[model samples]
Structure formats: structure tokens, C-alpha cells
Target: MSEVKKIATRDSYGNALVELAEKYDDLVVLDADLAAATKTGVLKKAYPDLHIDCGIAECNMMVVAAGMSTCGFVPFASTFAMFAAGRAFEQVRNSIGYPHMNVKIGATHAGISVGEDGASHQCNEDIALMRTIPGMVILNPADDVEAKAAVHAAYKHDGPVYLRFGRLAVPVINDHADYKFEIGKAVTLREGTDVTLIATGLPVSNTLEAAEMLAAEGISAEVINMHTIKPIDKDAILASAKKTKKIITIEEHSVLGGLGGAVSEVVAETNAASVHRIGIEDVFGESGPAVELLKKYGLDAEGIYKKVKSFI
Candidate 1:
């Protein structure tokens, strides 16, 4: 058998976008002139005419991409999540959400993992910001497999899509390549009946480890890998809630409006349960090592385990 080409989700974005551009001529790519850093330049190199470099103006680029989508063109807009979700939010809401435009937002450099780039470049709130937009599809892939699956799913799914990826090269959890991703469905990696640890992005692995620890201590915790933040899997959530009265949410984003908030909202509306959130605090992270920042923000495995235990 031929060896499979391994890929990081960020790199998958560049590769899959190029392949998509080649296959579909109606597909167009728009970048805010940060192609090299975000790897959107790869697609530009493969299909120059199909790529649009909108200088450094993200808001302007969003409006232009919306315009392109209106003309029956599928636009993959690339930019940092901070700018794409923070600066060009209104454009995304009106041009994309209101009209349900098929625009694939390649949001990169999300969370504190953007390391040495400092706090300004880190966008931990992209999920929260985008998920609030009605009709928006929020994506946070754990590894390259989920990333590729996410890309294919986004292409199949219509309406405004915010695809979030990080700068850090995390361990390829989906390395076995059996990673099955669903848009609105959360996957149960480990099933237990004591408690449910719902996680998104890289934190899913941490929650997995924490669940193992909980098991060793005679607590069988259920772990759900929630790759999709918006259009969340309420079915899986309710199932977990019924099985485990104690629920905890872990995310690489701020405690508000991200995975934690999303889970809490569902638990509050449908099923009643206690939810302990493990994520970056509301405070802005300072310049430091990536691992240290994660520990300080309480997103590490130990932190997750501790928080889950506290709730139960």
C-alpha cells in the first residue's frame, strides 16, 4: 500500500483548498495579504487567477468575498481569526449570515498557541464571536484528520462557516487516520457513566487523559470530542447528561461564549446538570511559553482533571 501523506490541519487547509480550486473553477480564494504566514499563499501559487489578495484590509476583503459569493462564486476567505471575527464581524453577519453565503472562512492563529506573537495576534474568542452569528457554522478541528474532514464537511455545508485552526503543531491525535468527523455530531472517544468531559480543539486530548485518570481512581468519566461548536450535537449532549449527572467542558478559548458556554446553554435549556468549565480565564494572556500559558489559563490536563473532580 502507498504511504499516506501526513498533513497538519493548517497545511491541509492549503492543500485541500488548492485541490478544491483545481476541481471547481467557481471556487475563489481571498487573502488579506497574510498568505505566507497563514499558508493561503500556497493556494495562490497553484491557482493565481482564482486567488484574490486584498492587501491587509480584512474588512474590505470580507466585503469583496461576499460580493464574489453573490455572483455564484464559492469564496474561501483567509485571515487571522482575530481580524476575521473581530474586525470584519459586521460584514460576515450581513453579507454572509443574512444571505447565508457559501463563504469558507479560513481563520488561523487562534488561541494562545500563537506563542511569541503575543496577545494581540491571539484570538481566543473567534468561536464565541462567530457562533453568535445566526446561521453560522463553527469548526475547531483537533488534528489534521479532523481538519481535512472539516474542510470536506464545510464544502458540503452551505451558509457562513468559520473554520478555526491553531499555529502550534499539536500531536496528530488522528494519526491512525480513522478520525471520523461530523459537522453537528460530537464523537464519543471514551464512554463512561460517572461524568462527561466535553472538549474542543487540542483540549480534547487533555480531557481524554483526564478521563483516564478519573477511571484509575474508580470514576468512569465519559469523554466527548466536540469538534463542532456551532450547530452543536445536542443529541449526544443530552445522552451524556442523562448518563452522567456531572458535566465539564474544556476548551482552548475563554470561558465565555466558547465550548463551555455552548455546553452550559444546552444543559440549561434541555437537561439540568452541573457544568464545570476548564479554559482560559476572562483575563488576557501575557507573553510567555505556550505550555506555561496553557497551564496558567487552566486548560491543561491536570487542570481539567482537577476541575472535573471539583464538580463531582
Candidate 2:
């Protein structure tokens, strides 16, 4: 078997996007003035005619992408997660979500990974905002391979898709695995009967680490990589709930309306008794390293392992 190496999601997006552009001539990339940060500059260099930088006008970029969706072209509006989800919510909701447009929102520097940029640049509530919109597919890839699969899946998918990528170079988790990223499908990475840890985005990597630690402690921990947060794999979650007595959720987003909230909604109705949430704890992020933000906000691997182990 090939060794699975960890890679950052944004890097995967950059590599996969250029590949997609080469394969699909209709694949166009538009940035709301954040081509470099969002890694769309590679596509710009490769396909200058197919790439457009909208000069910091996120609203116009959203409208233009929607317009392109109405036509035959496939558009990916690359930008910081905060601006793409916060500044252009209406356009995303009305123009893209409402029409179920085939536009892909390639959001980079998501969550506390914005780090030194402080709270203003961090997308704490981005998942909450996107998950609320109708007909929008939410994908928070865990690693490079998953991010690449998500990019290809978004192009194959018919409706609007939101891809949240981080700036940090995380340890590669999906690099050596033979995996197929499916929309609304949850990946069961490890099996455990004590507790189930369902995580998305950056936290999925932490979840894997936590699961390994838990295993050493004689605690069987089931880990689920729920990349698609919106159409969250309900059946897989419920299956875990039935098998495992406890449930834990981890995400690089707020505790309010993110993966935890989505999983809670499912488990609450399913008569689940033990539920724990690991996230930003309904607080804004601080200006620091991503690892520091995760620890301070109780979203890191050690934090999750401690909390999950308490149940056992």
C-alpha cells in the first residue's frame, strides 16, 4: 500500500484547478482580487485568457460568476473565505443558490488559518452562512488528495458548490490513500464502539491524530471525515450513533452553525444521549498561529482526545 502523506487543502486546490482548467476548456477562474492568496494565480499564469481578477470587488465577482454559470462556462470564484461567504452572501444565495448554478466558490485561507491577519480575516462563521443557503453543496476538504477530489467532484456536480481551504500546510492524510471524494458521503476512517468523532475540514486531520492516541489508550474511537458539511452524511452519522454510544464533533468553525450543529441536529432526533462538540466555542479567533488558535479555542487534537476520552 502507498503511504498516505498530509498536504494542505489550498495547495491541492491550486494543483487540481490547473489540471481541471487544462482538461476542461470551459473551466474559468475569477477572483475577487485575491488571486495570489487563494492560489488562483497559478491558473492565471497557466490560462491567462480564462482567468480574471475582479479588482477587490467581491460583489461584482459573485454576479459575474453567476452570470457565467447561466451561460455554458463553469466558473470558480477564488477568494478569502470571509469575503466570499460574508461579503457576497446575497449574490451567493440569490443568484447562485437560488438558481442552483454550477458555479464553484473556491474559498482559501478559511478559518483561523488566516492567523496573523487577526479576527477580521478569519472566517469563523463561514460554514454557518454557507450551510444555511438552499441548494449549496458545502465541502471542507481535510487534505490535499481530498481537496483535489472535491475540486473534480464540484465540477461534476450540477449545482452551486462551496470549497473551504486553509492556508496552513497540514500533515498529509489523503495522499497515499485510494479514495474517492463524494458529495454528501462521510468517510469512516477508524472504527470504535466507545465514541464517534465526526469532523470536517482542518479538524479532520486532528481527529485522525486523536483517534490514534485514543487507540493507544485502549479506547476504540470511530473517526468520520465528513467533508461535505451541508448535505452531511446523515446515514453514516446515524450508523455511528447506533454503533458508538458517544458522539463528538470537531471543526475549524464556530460551534453554532457548523458541522457540530449539523451533526447535533441529526443525533438529537435520533435519541442520542452523549454528544460533545469541539470547535471555536462560539468565539471569534485571535491573531496568532493556526495551531495556537486551535488550542486556545479547544479545537486541537489533544483537546479533542481529552474530551472524547473522558466519556470512556
| Estimated TM-score for each candidate | 0.93, 0.96
How far residue 11's Cα lies from its native spot in candidate 1, in Å, is 2.2
Best by TM-score: 2
In every candidate, how many clashes are there? 0, 5
lDDT of 1 at 100: 85
Q: Which runs in model 2 stand beyond 4 Å of their true positions?
A: 1-6
Alpha carbon lDDT of each predicted model:
0.84, 0.87
lDDT of 2 by residue, 1-312 (tens): 865565667878888989998889889999877777788888888889999889889888988999998889999998999999999999899988988888999999988877889999999899999988988999998888888899999999898999999998877777564777889999988888888898888888888888999999888888999989979898998989999868889888888999989998998897864787888876688899877878877677888888787756
List ranges where model 1 is wrong by over 4 Å: 1-8, 176-178
Clash count, candidate 2: 5
Q: Residue 303, candidate 1: how far off, in angstroms? A: 2.2
